[model samples]
Structure formats: structure tokens, C-alpha cells
Target: MTETLRASAPPVATGAGAIAVLRDLASYVDARAEAFSARSSWLVAAATHLAGEPVVVVAHEDGQVVGLAALSVTRHRGTARVTLLGGELNDYGQLHHDGPRAARALAGALVDWLRAQRRWSLDLTQLAPEDPALAALVRLLPGAVVSPGAPMPRIEGVGTSYRVKRDRRRKATGAFNAAGRDGLRAEKLVLDDLAGLERWLPALVEVRRARDHASGRRSQLDDPGVLAFHTSVVRGAVAAGAGVVHVMLVEDEVAGFVTVLVDGDTHRLYDGRVAERWLAYRGGTVCDIEAVLRAQDDPGVHTFDWLRGWTEAKFGNAEVVRAGLHASSHPSVDRLDRWEATARRRLKAALPDAAVRRIVSR
Candidate 1:
């Protein structure tokens, strides 16, 4: 076994230097089967439009970069708060690293550096439960508040259970039959035209919005900033051939689309939107199943990750369910954030879906 030689650098402010480090780390992570969220393109896209100051720490061994963590720092009433970079944008958070060993070393180095800093609060969310970094942090920080996060569902090849496979087949068949009966031609394609993509993106969002509105739920792509960030990510991914927009057209009209990010042998289901009118025909599910079928046929793809969310649509194809982590440590802010989150959840539950949507819209 090679002995680990660890050296940590001072926090680098967000800029070209930080981006370069992220790119290097992303390349390292991408070469392995690491989370797609940790890929270079996603990190760069998220870092470019950070909501707070970024503090990037790079770790090295034998003068070679091994791992890094990008953090966002914000101040409220003179109290500094730190969070994982692009926490909102990521489905899983882990320090970008070479592998498990590098992950452990980098996590230790990061914890040491953070301990040396002045008074500040740390809130790390969307952390993968088995992530070595997360394990190290939980072990080192005793008083940290650790919470169970959302479940991320994923499909392993076809499906593990007969029920799941049956559901998927039923949906796929019924959807296609419905389209045929309605005289609507349906086709799914790997969209590569940049100009056409630019035009269709807004329409996609609108379709998503309409679907959500019909369901009396709030849309994730409602914010302009969020839309802009997604655009950057989509464009970057498509340009590099690491991503593809699978569009499902019905009778020459847009019915639905899914944005997929390919990392190594895994194809992540990043974001999707379906026309409200096409919901009766399971347009969204058809688009997703089409991607899943294509991925299953590919010799390279081993996993179809639905990233995060436990929607019924994901369950039909999902064979595994993974959970994320949320941990927080602070002298003054401990438990407050968690309390607020709980309150928000309760309030959302108590209100009607349409009322909740109205509140979110305003």
C-alpha cells in the first residue's frame, strides 16, 4: 500500500484558480463512478453563479491534486455561515476526490482547516450517507445535528422486482397505444441542435410549469436564477457530449423532455418537464422510459439514476432507494435551521396544495 502524503492549501477565493482546481477534481471524480453532481461541468456551472462567497480548499499528495471541497460562505448579522457549494443545485454532496482513500484524507484535512477558522457555522446538506467524507465529519464533530434527508430513487438496469418491471411495461405500452389511438406521432431523440435547444428550453419550462399548476404543486424551475443556472449546466453538458436532452414529440408538438447527465457508466436523470395536456398519455413517463430503455441497450450504461425524489413515476423503474444527509454544527445556530425546516414542512402539509403554490409564487 502506498503511504498517504497529505498537504492542504489555504482557502482559495472563487475565481479562475478555484475553477481550475474544481475542473481537476471533477476530472478525477468523473474518471471513477462518482456522483454526477461532483463532475466538473456541474461544479463549474454551480460555482459560476454562487449565492455567497466561495472558499475552495484543495488537497494534494506527492504534489498531485487528490481532492477538494468548495464551500459557500454567507454572513447574517456578523455571524458567518458556511454550506456546501451549490447546495440547492446538487442532489448528492461529497468532496471531489480520486477515491475512498483520497476522500478520507481530504475530509480530515478539511475538518482540521475548518476547526482553525474563527467562529462560524457549518451546514452540509445532500451528503451521501456512505460518503467517506460524511463519515469522517460525523465522527469528528460530536455535537453536530444529523438529519435524514430525501430519498433518491434509481433504476438498476431493468427492475429488481416483478411488480416494478410490470408497471414500467404497462406504462410504456399504454402510453404508446394512447398516442397511436389519438393519431399523435411520438418520437424521442437525442437533441444536439444548440439553436433548437435554446428555443425549446423555455417551452420545456413552460410545459413543466403547466404540469405542476395542473397538479396544484409548485414548480422547481419557477425562479429565473434557477432557470439560468440550469441553462448553463445544460449547455455545458450538451457542448461536451456529456449530457443530452431527450425530447419526446407528439404529432410534431413538444410533449415532454428529460435532461440527462452522463458520467462514466451512469446516466443521471437530472431534470424533466412534460406537457400538461399529454399527462393523460403518460408523456413524462414515456420520455423517461425511452431514456431508460436506450440506456439499458447501451453496453456502457450500468445505472439509470433518477437523482433525487421519490415520485410514483420514479418508483415504477427504480430498484434502489438512497438517502442523503444533512449535518449542521455551530455555537449559536444549532437546531434553529432544523426547526425552521420542520415548521415549513408542517405548514406545507397543513395548507392546500393550491394555497401552497400561491404562497410560493408570491
Candidate 2:
């Protein structure tokens, strides 16, 4: 396939203009009937909220929308980042097409466009090492580096066989029991029966903030765009039977919260946070346990994945039955060989390469 690069064209990218493009994106995704990253309603919602001064690029072949990707340019620390926005949204997402070289072409076009912006660097965190789509990225962007984002653990799932490891099951059960003895409790709340949306949003954000404080991490809920996306898209998921929010609470206060996308019989764990003080209770890890088990309990729901991870917490743990991430993102040539090697070398220089390799390998 020949490469066709197109920058974010304006006529189709204004606030109202993007709607049609976004709709096209959604339609292109559905046309595949293939599980896709850009297809998630929640992600689209998040993008719609955060896509300020952003660029939307589309790839075409013989007049058909073969592939597309969005770049949200957000100003951070006096610099603008062409972020792929892979959070609760698309951490484990891959190229949206199965056609020959379509994924690679899409990725290459995006990287070439980003380089045109004349930015200091392009940041793509937590892309799976062997993704074919990224194969073209290194060639396009010669100085890019790949690094781990947040550490999100997941269970392995195959064609029709996906299960959490025995050790993880044992430890999760033990953690649940131990925490339970200390007055820690976690219940997956179904807001289906809740009175109305007026009250849920506030409690929702508050619970998330508390959980993040407990986990010693920032709360995504505190972000206006993220919270708004949840409120808007979650309603749609519930209506479609593909959306459910799992609230993990310790007693009366909210310990942690996760908003999951129940697409058919499978559930993709999306955005989440754990209260900081609850770290002693393994709030984040255990919260994942509680959410995953709840998803598994439903006969309609069979799989749960914590989108992406480069940290040791989720990726290298037993909780992951399978371990891979969104295989998108372009890294420079040297960094491609050891995508995370530099970071590992500097921070973990004291340790042996093998030991650091396990922790840093995505």
C-alpha cells in the first residue's frame, strides 16, 4: 500500500463540523464489526470534550475510509502534546483495520503529521512492542521514544478462553478477606435503579476524588472532560446494554470507582481511581479485583481488561491472564530496540537488566 499523509484539514474539523467526521469515525468503526478502539462511545465522548484546538486526520483508499486517528493538542507545562488520549479510553487499542497494511499506513500518516507540527517531540505511551501498525512509525519519526504510562494490570484472554491466573485469584481473595476483616468493603453498585442523574454525578466525582486521595494518585474524575464523558456516554451504554459503572466502596465512603464498557458479553474496564488513604488496603489493585469479579459474575460478561500498563503493578502481576497493550505509537530506531530501555537504565541502573527488563518490558 502506498502512504498518503493528510494534516488536520479545517473545513471538517470545527466544533460542529467534527460531529459529521466523528459520526464517520463511528460508522467506519461499526463497518468493521471488529472490536475497535475508536468505536467506543465513552472514548468519543472523552475526545469530544478534550479535543480543543485539536486536529482530526482521516486516511482514505479508493474513496473508502480505510483508517483514521485523532490528535488532541493540549497545552501542558508550557508545551503542547499531540496526545493519543489513551486513558480509560484506549490504552490497549490497536489499528482499527484488519486489511493488509492498513494499520501501518494509518499510524505512519499520524506520525508524519505530528512531525509537521514542528513540536519538540511526540509522546506515545504504552504501545505493545510488536504491533505491526507501529512498524511504519519508527521509520517515519526517527527520534521518538516509547515509555510506560500508568501501570494497569489485566487478565489474559484468548480466542474464547480467557481467565485470571490461579495465583491472582488466591491473592485477590486473600486481599478481599484481609481487608474485609479490617472494616474494608467493596460492592459494585448498579445505578440502574438510582433515582436520577442530578445527584449521581456529584457523588460520583466525590467518591473518585476520595479514592484517588487514598491511592496517592491523581483522580481522572476531577478532570471536567473525563467526568463529563462518563456522565454522557455511560447513559448511552446503559441504554445499549454495554455500559455499567462499578463503584468500589470501603464501608460508607467510596474507596475506588471504575466505569466499564460492557460490549456484548465482554467488559472492557475503562476509567478508574482509588482513594489514597486506602492504599494500605491495596485500594487500586483490590478495586480492580472487585470490578473484574463483578464483570465475570455476569454470564453476559466474560472478559475484563485494564486497558494498558508499563508499570509492574498490573502488567507483571498475576491478575493479567494475558499481557499486551494498545499496539499503536511510533518509537525512534534505537529506542525501538529497547523502547523503555533508557528510562529503565537511568532509574533502575542499580538492578540487573533481566530484573529491570521484566518490570519495564511492555
Q: Which has the greatest TM-score? A: 1
Off by over 4 Å in 1: 1-11, 15-17, 23-33, 61-64, 98-105, 116-119, 145-148, 157-167, 183-187, 192-196, 213-217, 315-331, 342-353
Q: Candidate 2 residues 162-206, lDDT tens each?
A: 545577667756655666788666554554433433345466677
Q: Model 2, residue 359: displacement in angstroms?
A: 31
lDDT of 1: 0.69
For residues 55-103, what per-residue lDDT tens digits would candidate 1 score against the true structure?
6776676776677787777876455677777776777676767777777
TM-score, per-candidate, Cα-based:
0.80, 0.63
TM-score (C-alpha) between model 2 and the true structure: 0.63
